[model samples]
Target: MARWESGAVEPDMATQAAMATIFHVPAERLSALLWPNWLPMGELFHVEGVWSPENCHSLLDASGDLMLERRGFVTLAAGSAAVLVREWQSVGRAVPEFLSGTSEDIALGFEGRLPWLRDLEDAHGGGRVRRFVDLELQYANELLRQTGHGGAGGRRLFRVVADLCRIAGWASADTGHLAAAERYFVLGLRAARAGGDRLSGANLLKCMTLLLAEAGRPQDALLLARSAVDATADGPPRVRAMLTVRQARVHAILGERDACERLLGQAETAMAETDGQPCPDWALYFDDAEYAAQVAACHLALGNYAVSDHLLERTTRLQPASRQRDGVTYGLWWAENAFRLGEPERAAAHLSETVPLIESGFSTRNRTRFAQVRRLLHPHRTLPQVRDLDARAASLLAWGA
Candidate 1:
């Protein structure tokens, strides 16, 4: 054990299996995952406790320690993820206890800064904005500790903290801190529940679903997506549409074409039902362009490369100029699809176009995706276009480093 902890020796498969048994992890999961990847490191899946302000505070405190741990990405096992979602759904709705306090103005102040922070993240990328986001989260935590969860102000404060958690989680995920992201999401969900903000809670679940899907846990992602949809049965039409599209993306990943198309159609129908009624501030980002991009992603997952490419072009053009990170992301996706479509030259050209944008910004997620594309193009490295792309990508990687 000492040798394993010091990295001098790894636990053999038998030792790992025994450790898994002690940790309550399933044997099959241990076999499926690499050595330490099977270990359950966070309390996100520990659904044994009751949902309350105290529990939320405890989680928030633990999350601060989690932020300092730079361990690599680790996702919940499919069974564990399913259990977590079920526990989340079964927890009683917590209402903020009203006490003598005046924090409404303070909560509003935090709320006002959210849009600017979000814009910075979207424009510059998560690596640039993550520290700022983490600072905001810490501030929110301080407020929670000082204010004592009660009063109308307390409820509003919880909502603000939940928003901060969502942003922090997203930034962490973008910067390749997946463990921190998952913890933040769980804490945010608890905060949202404490504040009775169903919409925000649903959003957190949606974010978690996407995160799991990106981590190659589509089955777990699908479960969470379904739970989000069910929980938001009476939510705004646009929000419902957004969640449905996300579920469709997971279905596409799982190669369930018919289910994916059916969900996509449902999402479109929900969008048509939206009469521009004021949606939640968070849901407003799922506009026409965003919707098209999500649909394109679903198609990409389903292997409809040509259709995905067409929609991606439109999506990129429709994106706001300030959303440079998003533009670069879509451009990368386009390149991946091109490669999948057997057009290495086109793929190389697309990848070359994104290099300048990537060098100018900072997104670990985008950089990771860029690496994936480079690997895809490696076999044709001798080609002229591929050679040019290699040179450009090499410089971008050095800049990132």
Candidate 2:
């Protein structure tokens, strides 16, 4: 508090919200009190926690969104987490209901466009689309308070919020803002739980698992993946299949080949059960190509280079070019496996193709993978092809920096 007053520090979004709860005031009120110039004192005191209709409309103005740097977790105390959970539960009810459209209409409008937004993220990378998505989410959240459907309407709105949060979290992680992504994922799960949408909650957990695993915390990834499977045990078949695939990846990381294969088989069985059923919109993209990519990843981790290379070949061909991030990732994996197979020329060729996509997408996730590829090729830098690859890799890093 002293540091904050001294202008040497400021609370993060989570901290500010927590403080608001403790002070029995709204977060914006706390902000206004702390920084007198932020909002007119008379209006701030009158508005308190809830925004007036005019204020809500004005908040929708598309000013630039803030970008926060990533940080590791400082574990929440049990009591604090519980309080946080309660605060999240009240979010929908607390929102000021001043939107032009009816709640259902607003939700449907957002839902209808979400697929397009998701596709844009997949094609161009998170840095390009995150701000737009954030603005849309803020608008959707405000609409929740004004929805007209009673209990049913509230649940539907909450479901949409959950999905939007999940997408935003994915984009954050892809752009390397892991701390912000963690906050978004937690909020998404909270929204899902509030709405009694176990499937969406579990899906968010699976995404968190993927982020953790990719960031080199396999144990944390495994725990979250297991939680997802258990939470959705009796939920949608496709979602169960997706979570099980995540389990297999963690098993592979643990070097348990038999365990990995067992879970993979289970994942396949779960997927088969969904053959004639309509899967959740989020799980629809976890198709054969995605399955193959998971399998390739497991084998690659286990040092089964030949098998990984074969599976990656199929994955690369089957995966659409528009999903530039995934394409570049798969290409990097293929190149790594080729290098492990004593084929530097093949590796160099794959790296050459991947570099362009990585540059175009500007993904930190793919850039990190490329860094590993560069390190793997360093031993052979004397070769002309390796040297050329190294030069391109350096240029890519410089441009990103």
Candidate 3:
């Protein structure tokens, strides 16, 4: 072992195979670790009808970078990354295997269920939607692994799968499962690339940025947000605006007021340019109320309590019925800011109003945010309204249990 470690000797093929078997890893993986330079090109990855050797090499290089940044955020694009273009070009050639379902039927099915599923997510929470989406993803992946479909049908199917994965990832993040969220985002990106959907991949990166930003790694979040923007530089106006909002959020986290406001203005401009252009299904939800919420979050982060309060009020009033999660979330923020501005009674009232929705099993984000509000109001626990609000929140939070 010492001699092998010192590079005085190399393991024979038989020994390498034995080592791989013992370690429960593929022989190719073992070889790459031991004699990487000595192995030929095709030997790098022994498996696959999916990715070419070049693609595998790119992914392998990316895995190294991801490992280094494991605790922080990892950018989706790898070295020499024209990932979307490459995946687009390689689509027909990469996998000749046929999938079972007609892409049209699958598409129709997805469309029929999407609205209901989204509403469920809003009303119930990520916990309710995640398992359902996860199962769909699993089935879609299995279909891709089969033989029978190819060409445009295959690409269409892949895109649908990608979209489902994106939704699943979003749900996971809503539940505060950041690690699971990252895995789904990565998988979703691969499926998006395979479908030649650059916009979808860019959106997944944006999701990652949001996840990292909320997890408190602002530097990493800023880098990922920039990557999302660069990836979709010339994409749809609404899509660009969506990504720009995330970038603005990151800037806010980093305390860059000027940069945040600049990007927010750019987002507003992009939204205006969207005009009559067909918005992607994924971006249809980026409405005025949502934009207002994003702005409020930025200002709230930057200590502009009064401005944020005005925006939050407008947002909750705009579409309270449609945006269940947003209404509850903005309500929590309003309460927090109210207390910050030395209005404990207003804060208690705001919290009181939002508590019923919080008990609706919507998202951990609302619950978590409310907990922070609770902490903020703790110092004023002697106040009757504050005491009542605390009891109500605690009871709501412990309802199912």
By lDDT, the best candidate is 1
Ranking by TM-score: 1, 2, 3
RMSD of each: 5.8, 9.5, 10.0
Clashes in model 3: which pairs? Answer: 98-147, 98-148, 98-149, 99-149, 125-362
lDDT of 3 by residue, 1-401 (tens): 43342234777878767755775777667656654223322122111235432242233233322112211222232321234334433443232122334545545565456667666666665756877776665555455456323556556666676677677776776776554566667666666666667677778878877776775567766776787777766777888998998999889988999999999899989989887876557787888888888888888888899999899888888865866777888888888888878899999999999888878665776777777777777788999998888788777546423
Q: What is the lDDT of residue 85 in candidate 1?
A: 76
In model 3, the runs with Cα more than 4 Å from the true position are 1-106, 147-150, 396-401
Identify the runs in model 2 with alpha carbons over 4 angstroms from their true place.
1-66, 69-106, 148-150, 397-401
Better of 1 and 3 by TM-score: 1
**Deviation in angstroms for 15 in model 1?**
12
Q: For model 1, how does the per-residue alpha-carbon lDDT over 1-401 read when each residue is reduced to its tens digit?
A: 43453234788878887888899998888888765556775322444467777788777776666567443354454486777677778765443322223544558778779898888877875645767867777877788789887766667778877888888888878878786788778888888877778778878989998888877778888988998888777777998999999999999999999999999999999999878666777787888778889999999999999899999989988988887888888999999999999999999999999998887787888887888887898798899999988877787656444
Model 2 Cα lDDT, one tens digit per residue, 219-284? 767777776777667766777888898888888988989988898899889888987766578787
**Model 3 Cα shift for residue 346 (angstroms):** 1.3
Lowest-sum lDDT 10-residue window in model 2: 39-48
Predictions in order: lDDT = 0.79, 0.68, 0.67
Model 1: residues with Cα > 4 Å off, grouped in runs: 1-45, 75-78, 91-105, 397-401
Candidate 1 global lDDT: 0.79
